[model samples]
Target chain A: MMVTGKKHEAAAAPSGAKLDLSHVSKVFRGGQGVHDISLSLEPEMIHGLIGANGSGKSTLLSLIAGQRFADSGLITYGGDHVNEHAAALSQICLVKTYERSWENYSLKEIFKFASIFYPHWDEQLASELMDKFQLKGSKNYQQLSRGGQSMTGIIKGLASRAPLTLLDEPVIGLDASMREIFYRTLLEDYSNNPRTFVVTTHLIEEAENLFERMVYIKRGRVAFQGPVEDFAANAVYASGPATVLEKLLGDVRVLHSERLGGKLLLALEDLSGPAERRMLQDQGVELSPVPLQKLFVYLTLRDAENSQGGGNR
Target chain B: MSYRSLMKFHLKDYRRGALILLSIFVCVDTALVLLMKFLPAWDMGTADNIFSINRNIMSIFMIISMIVTVAITFPLMSSFSVTRRNFYVSSLLALLAFCITAALAETAVYLIGRAVLPSIGLPVDVDRPILLSAYVFMLTLLDVSVATFLIGACYYRFKVITGTLLAIVYFGAVSLISQMFPSMEYMENFALFSSDPAMLEPGTTLLAWGIIALCAGAGWLIYRRTDIRM
Candidate 1:
């Protein structure tokens, strides 16, 4: 359903390393943090992670980055446990927003160091992209401004070309123009040498189009996940005769509903498609697709209402 | 990356602090030498030539040591807690600097001792290889060990601090409680050494190495358990 996706084509995953994050339950000593989450990530796609602060987004990234160890569950890269097996994690790269604090080296120096660790580092591409990002390679890390520092990290993440790339808000300080450039560069890079990318961001609406899949994390758990088309296809605008919309709610879960001067507007789950649309049309109903943001809000609120226990996060 | 390349990357980061430290050391050393020459000599009965290191000199060293420790650990006092990878990187740099400082301090003391000993009319043992080597080695070992323990204790207490009071209090309390108490001596009483001062004290050297290893291990363990971004 997206702009460029094939209609009759099989779902061919992007080519690069596959991530198997299975049964990942992490809890703080006093019984806090995320728990019992499980998901597998395939390559050649941009995965969006959406959540409010302290919702275990950063913790999940940290666990993947080798920054923090999980109390339980295993994160497998290329089918091997990353924490226990060194070989497994070599290809997966997680670049956190504050990762530079762990390193004091200059952008160029760190990149040089990373090249040896990440065998597939593309130096020429890094230099070219650095120019585009307007970063100073020779500058010391302490000297760069926040946005510039973020640019440095983004450059490293893109340049590494590691099989699995996790960017946790790498564009925090970027201007809108720079962010657009980043998205373009990301798309160009991915198109050329497709790798699995997981982008965690607050600016979901702007980048929703790029996400092959979106992981809307609510209260430290996967609230919803799957291909954008599949998830988007589930979105339905079931505006109809008030009685028909109300009665139609029995089998379909309506994510959102509104009464527009007695005419009803209801967003329902994706039931069996055309026949239901036809049935609704026959009953003087209306239907349409939901924007990514509306879907996020509706699903988030629904998940919150359902749980009543995710703690206000 | 290869180990040497990794080290170079970490070591290159000391550009700012090292330059700042080198300049401060140069200026302070110049000013101190001038001040010493400008002042009248303190009286030392029966030791006219000896440049006796007393309360003043010791206090200067104490201040300088604290300053160096503060400067060295500045980068670590952040929301980002150290990781095992970062621990190795920073420790390697710290170790190298510690060695270089020990060498310079020992050399300066030797020269000052040579000049001051003759002035005090004491027979200077310029060729006393055993004494010189033992004293140099002991002083170097003492400097590195003391510094390591000081940082370890400070890092353990607050993980990071800016106020001088916390650094001084934690460092003083830990060093005094651990070393001054007869039953709680550093390294020497861990049953890790059999050195007796009058009997060559060779086991003391072994104890020093053991203590260094223990501190390194402790540092790594602390880093492993701390929050990723504390």
Candidate 2:
């Protein structure tokens, strides 16, 4: 079956800045970091940075935000080097899950300093979000619950109104209803104020609909980068008899395969075209769409298998 | 503009803590001075020594405050897209302001005590020249502040374990050198300002400034390259 969903429209004329990373790399002493990542992110679009834990997602965001200097290569925003250009750095905001330095500060104090530093900080919006999240400005950050702490970071990211805002696991501790409110507020804000947003989250399915572009990182490399719809369309599951499926999927990269009773369910990547998919369907193979979360799991599992010399299982 | 704003923010953040520290010193010293006045038999020295005692306490306070300020504000400012240069410069300015404030407060307390205690029939002698003492106290506090700021920067850059070890090694080296040259007294002259205004040495003051410059430069190099780990 075809992966049918509401394809996100092309972003409106960009009020935000463009970001480009060319051959960027950062390696830690323990040998884990991003490597040779070259990517171009257009303005005024929501980009999802998806990856497994320790896949350099946070490192990549840090490099982009100038929080961590890249070991090599260049990262530019609005045609200026992010780290070298003070103006460019000022236009970007990156919010992490937890900031140890913030523990002693109250939310009111945080906002006070943020307003001084972020030239375009939206005080009214910050206040409104605080109310919506049911957080007290007088409470120190360390006194908040885990979810409340996440809300504080989220409020900062949203209220900064920077041209490029990067949120790393913004909804980590948010409950279901709070998460829904966050999604709603984010989309509403984007509609009103179009800018570049790069959100890294583990909840792929929940955020899938919000992302216009998806960048998948695997083992410190860019495994895939394209529109979310294209990412979903490129890989799929084809379940049928083992022998028939094998004959049909010749030479194609199988991301995952499992034997269920007498049948085989294979997750295949880069399926050629409609003609190939139809042919598989004609061969008594039931082709179905793969969910974004499932596709991520399958891809990571496939990489793990390949690394262990278990080829195309 | 951002630099000025950051400087202002830091001053605001630190002022309350500075006031609280100053208050604690004033309260404790006031109580001590009162006890000494009422029970002259318990008095160990001239009451005018409060000025020097307060200067010593302020020096220790300056070091602790600088370290805490850097540890707290570096990450906070970095998160706000503050450049390392701006953060460092603004922090230094704030620390200088704090040292100056502390010096003025100490001088005011001493002048007040010298004037009031003698009028109240408590014998108090002027042990040190007031203006010279204030100048010495300010310079001494500044030197300690800069040195402590460098250590704080090192702590953030190298992380907790290595930073703590480095601090221990540094103090150990200083102590060993002081023990080896007990007669020379060079370490004491290098580390502290003379409480007696007549004994104030220009060479010692210049050495303090040189050490401040060295620490500021080295700290900036480390801080500029340091990653803002969340």
Candidate 3:
């Protein structure tokens, strides 16, 4: 669904093999799970899955990758139901910090296993990425530092080149310089061979630019999923006299607000059209675009604030 | 393609362990046979065929090997995008191949011993045939390997406490059924080949095959429904 404000038009015909989830739910013990998550991903674009630590981003990715089975609903990829279809699963590659499977194996040994099993595995790409990442072939997987481990996971995801590649917290422990290298390499790889990628990460501002579409998950459901531009275009930061701002934002959705002296600063959702902006501008209010990261923070915190029965601090 | 890849991966993973175990077994067996021949003071009148010795050794090793391999391979199966069904089938296939190879290797070792021992004046009286004619021996190896796989799957699908408790209850029920049916002589007779290599009765062979099928089927069900913990 479009964020509370903007009305999205019918999307273009799906470009390629789409990843589709319909009413999927997977509940773990203690009631932690994704609930009724229905999303369709068009092929050959990067989508960012942004959520808080317990917001089910990781769980949703796992279900999509077929690493975990859904309790109810259907997950399909490229026209095949992934849960029971081995061929369909083979088309998707999930790169996670798998602490168990390859812990005893050396980096070279893991590469061998990856190349053997992944149909689209690119040995040359893997070797090149390994060199770039400076990962030693002889080091045991479990022996690597956290960043070193993340580098190995990144190489696997990029080199697999499956139709749908998922990287959950791919850059968990990388330094700033290394993260830059990852982004550059990721972009280069995507350009060289386009595919669908769903990356779940906490470094939103750093990686937001790379995402063509953004999916905001809150409390196990999709709060928003649309083009990144759509998300950013929907939120506006407005500041003006407190009384004027209150009257101007009368019925408009105020996601976040701050009282600075007598002037009030507000983050409003779905205030994109020229008519609303012009009307607010005429009322002597200053407006600027809210960054995707700030909008995410505002939306998530607003929900939490409402649930807890507290006004925005 | 996925099945073949999984089998190759399993073989690679198990290569080191299998080699070490086989090497140790062969070395110990060969050393003992040589000691018996060269040092008469150490030699006993008792006959020792490599196959007979390994029949017991391999059964224990195979069970351990199967359990460890299944535990290690289960997670890798998901990482490599191999389906749970394929993982179960491919692992079972790998174990079957491993058992067949071990069976053949034991037979060859026995044949070699038959030739080499006499030349060294330490002939062994192998009462049982070296290969499939030792039907109960081969069946025991296969049964334990598959049963151990089921145990590993159980531990994987359910964590330790629940898995262990369930296994105890299930085995207890099986024992109760076996006790209730005194005519199920195969349960007791299957291990009798250690003393004598009497041919397994056709009915007993059928029952043995059925039990193998049941264990393998149960293992598959557990694996098929298991969710990979990321």
> Residue B40 of model 2: what lDDT?
76
Report the CAPRI category for model 1: incorrect
Question: Which sequence of candidate numbers ranks them by lDDT, best first?
Answer: 2, 3, 1
Residue B74 of model 1 has an lDDT of 30
Per-residue lDDT tens digits for candidate 2, residues A159-229, read 88787999999999899999999999999888777888999999999999999999999878898899999
Second chain alone, TM-score for each candidate = 0.50, 0.84, 0.80
Give the candidate number with the greatest TM-score: 2
Clash count per candidate: 4, 1, 0
Q: Candidate 2: which pairs clash?
A: A1-A287
Error of 3 at A267 (Å): 3.5
Q: Provide TM-scores for the models.
A: 0.73, 0.89, 0.84
What C-alpha lDDT values do all the predictions have? 0.59, 0.79, 0.76
lDDT of 1 by residue, A72-170 (tens): 787877766665244445566777776534355577766665655554566776788789887877887677777777787787787767667888898
Interface RMSD of each: 6.2, 1.4, 1.4
Itemize residue pairs with steric clashes in candidate 3: none
- Candidate 2 chain B lDDT trough over 10 residues, lowest sum: B183-192
What lDDT is reached at residue A168 by model 2?
95
